[model samples]
Every structure is written in C-alpha cells, then in structure tokens.
Target: MLNAAETRCDALIVLADVDHVIHVPLPNFTFQRSIDLQGILKSFLRKALVERTGQIERWDRGTWESFLSPLWKCVVEPVMDALAFSTPGDLSRIFWCPTGPFVFLPIHAAGLYDTKYSAPGHKVFDFVVSSYVPTLSILAPSRNIYVAHNDDFRLLAVRQPPTDGRRLSRLPGVHTELKHIKEVITNSGSACATFLEPSVGTVEEVLGLMNEADWVHFACHGIQDAKNPIDSGLCLANERRLKISDIIGLSRSRGGLAFLSACQTATGDEGLSDEAIHIAAGMLFAGYAGVIGTMWSISDTLAPIVARDMYEHLFRNGTRPDYREAAWALHEAIGRVRESGEVSFNEWVPFIHVGL
Candidate 1:
C-alpha cells in the first residue's frame, strides 16, 4: 500500500476537533451535535478519500469500512440518515471540512484561544471570504488570496435578538462604540478598497467592484439554512439570498480579499458544523487564498465599527501580532468608547473569529 504522503492525491480530508467539539449550538437552533460530526464525514470525508486513494491504492472496502465503521455508526451514518429526511433544499445547509489531499482546517471551536493542533497540515496558499469580516489573518497566517462573495450580517451589526450573558461578554458596546472605531480606519486610508452595496445588487456588480482591489469588504446580512448548511446565503436588501454558487463563480474569475460583514457569513448555523467552515469552506474550496468569518450573532449597529477598526489595524500593522492581539485591538477600541461614556460597557464583545 502506498504511504499517506507518498500517494499523490487529487484531494484531502481534514478532521477538525479530533480532540472534541462542543457540537451544541447556543440555543434556538435545530442542528444536533451527534449529527454534525456524522454529516461531516459522510458529506466530505468519503468523497475526498476516494478521490485521493482512487488513483493509486485499490481501496479495501472491508478495511476502509472497518476503519470508518466506528465513526459511521457512532457518527457518520446517523447524521446522514437524519439529513436524508431533510427536503431537497435542506441538505444544502449541511457542511463539512473535507480531508485528504485537499487541506483540512479543523479549529477547536471551544478552544480557539488555547494552543492546540488546530492549524492545517499543509502550507496555505490563499485567503477567501464572503464579506468584509475581521480576524482572518489572526486565525491563520498561511492564506494570501482572500475572496468575498456577498455580505455577512455578523460583519455589519454587533448584536441580534436573543442576546444572553455570553453574547454580552464578548461585545459590550457594539453599536455606537463600534461605529467610532470604523471612523478611524476609513479616514486613515488603511483600506486598499471598500465596497458598499446600495440596497440591491448582483453577483456581477460584486465581481466588478471586487476587481478593483486586493481586499474586498461588504457590509451586509447573511442568511443561514440551519438544516441545509450549504443552502445558507447572503441576505441582499432586494430580499434575495446570495448562494455559494454565486461566490464560486466570482472566485473563478478573480482573486484577492473577500470580507463578509453579514450575519452567519462565516459561522455555520446551529446543528451544523462548527468553526464557520460551511461558508468560509466554500470560499476556500472555490480557490480563494483565505477567508475570515464570525462565530455567533452580532449587534447590527456595532459590527461595522469593529470591522473597520480591525481592518485598519491589520492593513497598517500587518497580520502578525497573534490572534489575541487582533481581538484586543478591537476590544480596546470598543473599551475607549465606553470610557468616554458615549455608551455603557455592557454592550461589547459579540463578534468572534469564525475562520482562517
């Protein structure tokens, strides 16, 4: 049998959270933890393995089956069966980080701040995005070619409904405080280019506008299909959902930075996969350099403010200060607003990094 590295492959499979992932959503979500892992392997693992192993090794169905059987029974098969009952469009919301020749990035969702084996196994070559999201570089230094497809609400608003104690701790002064931060970045000229959609627009418009610069930023909303993760999309003001297909088309034609400042742009819906892999994964899969995404719901008014500040810091300072540094910069900036008494300190810390 050919060795893992020796076998030239067409793709790869990366398993995130080999250690453990919470698998549970915050609340008011439908995706189940047990199904999330199973769905990941079935939707992503099986095919990637076949693609890579197909060319050289004669797959031992029995051996492979035995190896995966435990995961299948304990993980894959169950999720696949559960998802099978889902409607045609429903499966689209399910997502997984494929492993094998293709790169697999599995972030320990709960342990992001902790030092662990979370980075990918290969040398990353690009960056991808759906909207103008902050903290991509901090997640991984390897990506270079970022891509942005539409808008992400998490990038725009700092808070959403059903806010709780955990949400409040992450972002205290999300509205006015965040806006103040954006003021510094926009006027500083730190951004190479910015794209602001006026109500309604098309993928073509985004593609054309994206062509103008190395970094792409969109302050908009993103819709997530909790059941079918892939079906998740950007919520355009025109009341349309920008699907991943639109993003793939755009990435095929150009390359640069893509930021999604919309809700769930990077973060997968509950019961779906963790690490915002579904959305950002599409950008990476479509051949972008890197993608940055958000973890949970955000404060609408405050999102732009934090996003603007984050970009300015990264663009001017460069993305080398470490993850916490980026988080701190944004955190501190928001803190200043609170100190100034423009807003209370209870409204900061909602937005979090969703991807690399």
Candidate 2:
C-alpha cells in the first residue's frame, strides 16, 4: 500500500449511500456469533480503505492476518451472514471506511467512521462507525476528514400535487419566487446574473449567458434517464433535454455556483463512475466552484422555499455562505415552516447540498 507521504492529492472525496446506513443494523446474535461476524466486515473495510486512501505503506500483512483477523471473526462475520440477505440497496451501500482525518464522505459514513460516533442519527451511523474506525486510525492518524449528512437524503415521495400541474405559471408565484432567489443571489454582489427557465430552454441560451455570468440557477425539472443515467438532463422550454454532456462543456467562471433546483440531478448509477454525472457534479468536475442539488423527488412548495433561503444566506446579510451553509439555510427555512404549523414536516424539506 502507498503511504500518505507518497500520495499526491491534498484530500479525498467519498461517495456514500446514506439510505444503507439508516435502514440496516448489525444482526442480533449470541456474543460469540457477533464476534465472528466482525472479521468479515473487517475484510471489506480493508479493501475499501486501500483503494480509497491510495496509501501503500500502511499495509501490514502479519498485523492483518493475525491480530485483526480474529477480531472480525468474532464480531462482524456472523452479522453479515445473517443480515446481508435482507439488506436493501441503501443499507448495503453504507460505507464506513475512513480515508483521512481530512476526508469528507457522505453523512452516513462520516459519523460512523469517527471515534465519537455517538452523535445525532447515531443508530444509523453505527454500522459505518463500528466498521471503519479501528483499522483506518492505525493506518492514517494524521489526516483531516469531514462528513456531510442530512435526513433529507432518504427517498421520500412528494405529498402535495403540483398546483398548475402543467404550466409554470400555475406553480403559485413561480416568477416571484425566482425573482426573490435571483435578487438574493445578486445582492451577494458577486457579479452573477440569474435566469429562470419557463420550460425547455436551449443550451445555446444557457451557454451564451453562462459564459459571462458568475452564477446560474435552473429552477426546472431535471430528468435522469434511469435506463441510461448519464443521458439524463434538465428540461428546458419546448421539452428539450439538456444532456449531462451539454452542461459539462461550459467555460470556467470564478467562484461560480450552479444551483440545480432539479430533482436527483446529483446522482450516479452504480458500477460506473463516468456514468455518475450529476448536473451539479458535472458542473463541478468541469470547473464550477460548487453545486447544490436534491437527492430524490421533492415537493414543489418546499423546493422554492429552500432555494429562497439558500440564496438569502448566500447573497443577503453579506454572509458569503458556502454551498453547505446555503443548503443548511434552506433546511433551516423549511424547519421554520414545520415550526410555524403552516405545513407538516413532510411538506417543505426536500433538498440537499452536493459539491466538492
């Protein structure tokens, strides 16, 4: 294995499946059986650690084969044999491997991989936490790591029907909401201009403005071709599909943030990293400063509310909020809705922040 000193990158990014951690738990078994289960868990952890950390010097054959081997034999293997059969995609995808002290993984793995794993959402965080901490701590003790997690990562069906159901105008003050978010963005005084697409807008129109604007906001439906996920894209005026490739080709802009108010615009299908082209991610990989996206289907009322709060956090109050902060602001805004008793908690809490 390569040592951290020999590695070239400054930080590591982990793609975690939050659903897995929230839904799966270690099997309930006799003390001896649980101990045996631990061993198998360790094996998978070791492999993921090696691949993700890219550290070659941490490898210790005898340490792994002898001391650690039995640890899993006694604790993790049994849990795997009993529960693996019933685990859902969300639970199965939970990864607890720790890369560095500075590594930033999705929430599920981040909290789980830490020593002080007893935090909010601790139960779901346990599977990952119990799985990775011991091994990685021994391998890399001097790196910095961070985790991003939220309850909204889970799949939730939209509860309310779209008001207009067909036309953008029927969306209950869609223009006003767009204007508010755009103004909040402009108030940041970042020289970024915002545009609201009514329907299927063209790539040429986007490219023309994106070339000069420091920020771009797309408050429209972004469809992911479930069959061919990368072919998925945002819908513009006229029912045109703006494929993932089209979004990736934009030129660079300084401190640019593309707020994709589109659904599941930040996901990738399993088995291929190249196919994991999220509109927000593609923009980031193509050199945008950051991107904010949703994880699954969202409530129409909630999305605009979240966007309004995010833009307010970013452009209003002179706060220079980053992508994460902006996303949180949106969450906070929705929390207020639940607090005020205007709508239930299920109404306006459907957004997540995705970025580098």
Residues 56-150, candidate 2: write the lDDT tens digits. 12323333333333323322333333344233222332223322221111222111212363343322222322211212222232222222222
Scored by CA lDDT, what does every candidate get? 0.37, 0.42
Q: Residue by residue across 20-120, what tens digits does model 1's lDDT show?
A: 33231112211243234335533533343221111222223343333333332333333333333323222221223423211121221111111242242
Question: Model 2, clash count?
Answer: 41
| Candidate maximizing TM-score | 2
The residue ranges of model 2 lying beyond 4 angstroms of the native Cα positions read 1-173, 183-192, 196-200, 270-275, 319-324, 338-349
Evaluated at residue 5, the lDDT of candidate 1 is 28
lDDT of 1: 0.37
Residue 291 lDDT in candidate 1: 49
Lowest lDDT 10-mer window, candidate 2? Answer: 151-160
